[model samples]
Target: MATFDARQMQSLTGLQATARTFLMVGFTVVETVALGLWLALVQGAPVISRPAAIGLGVLTVGLVVEHVLTDATVNGLSFSFPLARIVGISVSEALLWAVWLGIADRLGGVDGILVAGAVLSVLLVPQHSVEDNILRGEAPLSNVVNLNTIGFSLVEGIGATVWLLLVFEGQQFAGLLATLGFGGVDPAAVGLAALGIFLLVEHDIGVTLARQG
Candidate 1:
């Protein structure tokens, strides 16, 4: 009989980590875009909602800021560039959040947004767990319920909630806009500002944790 040694186990772990990363990146891109398209069809929009488009643009800027601040790089990339990580992660995150917001809007307006935020927070647990495990080269299910996961869930929930609130209630600022001789604040603009702040904070925390690990 033959058995694996420590070196062999380590090598296997590395291979698993690389495979998981590639799969996750690919799946995220596909799923996010698919979801956006589905939401567009449901909402009768040409492609995506105005708020979603604004959110994506703001998210891109936020990701660029995060990359500049952390100088973080995703591991196991065959080809690396100054903006590769930013572009990949930004597209995934932005599209996911855009479609998520669209769904929340349809669920029940303001109430639905809150519900969706909570749901997304819960879902992020497993997603973050997988990413964390990959970084440490640990087994897929190892230490899934951890402090970092919980913290990220909380952050995501709060961010999503605030973003949706601002977007939905953008009309609340109409009086202020009137004073400025403007028609009103567009919901898209409000969403952009709200999501930009949230993404910046969330990405900073995520990068810090990865660096610590």
Candidate 2:
């Protein structure tokens, strides 16, 4: 809710941002593995059986909508162009929060967070295969999608860290790492491993991985 002139963030975080790329990728790999192991369990749980998959399907749609909404939320109609993304973002956020909370009650909130973190990890890091995908006409990530996801994740990480620093009392060492946790990661196999879990969870390994000799 704080107003940022934008310049300050760049100065405060460019180096960290560059470094986070690597971290994000690493985080993604860990998440992929965790999800694979957990998805089957979650599906079999009494509370989540069948219905949870339906819920996840809904959440996936929400993720796409969140993309559109975030833009409208951030850059509203200026004197020049009316960015209508805010409405979408506001709605998406509310829905995701509600869905996450509801599902978390049964599914372990950590899983929800993991899913979000994993998705962002994939979108955040710069992957080499994007070019191959674009050429193949499979699923080309547009510039807008990539840019907005990066901006959103970067700001969200910083904002949450600031809030934690203010509200929570903790050791300086713990705080430092927590503050830096939103750090990004590299866009290599590590990052792929992280995100690939989601694909695998949905039984779509072929989508995440391409045969390279």
| Top-TM-score candidate index | 1
Pull out the clashing pairs in model 1: none
Encode model 1's per-residue lDDT on 107-198: one tens digit a residue: 86677888888877876676566455544445646766656866866676676676556556657656765676555556545554454455
- Deviation (Å) of 52 in candidate 2: 19
lDDT of 1 at 104: 83
TM-score, one value per model:
0.51, 0.25
Q: Which regions of candidate 1 are displaced past 4 Å?
A: 1-71, 74-99, 173-184
Q: Estimate the TM-score for candidate 1.
A: 0.51
Model 2: per-residue lDDT, tens digit, 85-117?
323333443343334334434344434444443
lDDT (Cα atoms) of all candidates against the true structure: 0.55, 0.35
Predicted candidate 1, C-alpha RMSD: 12.0
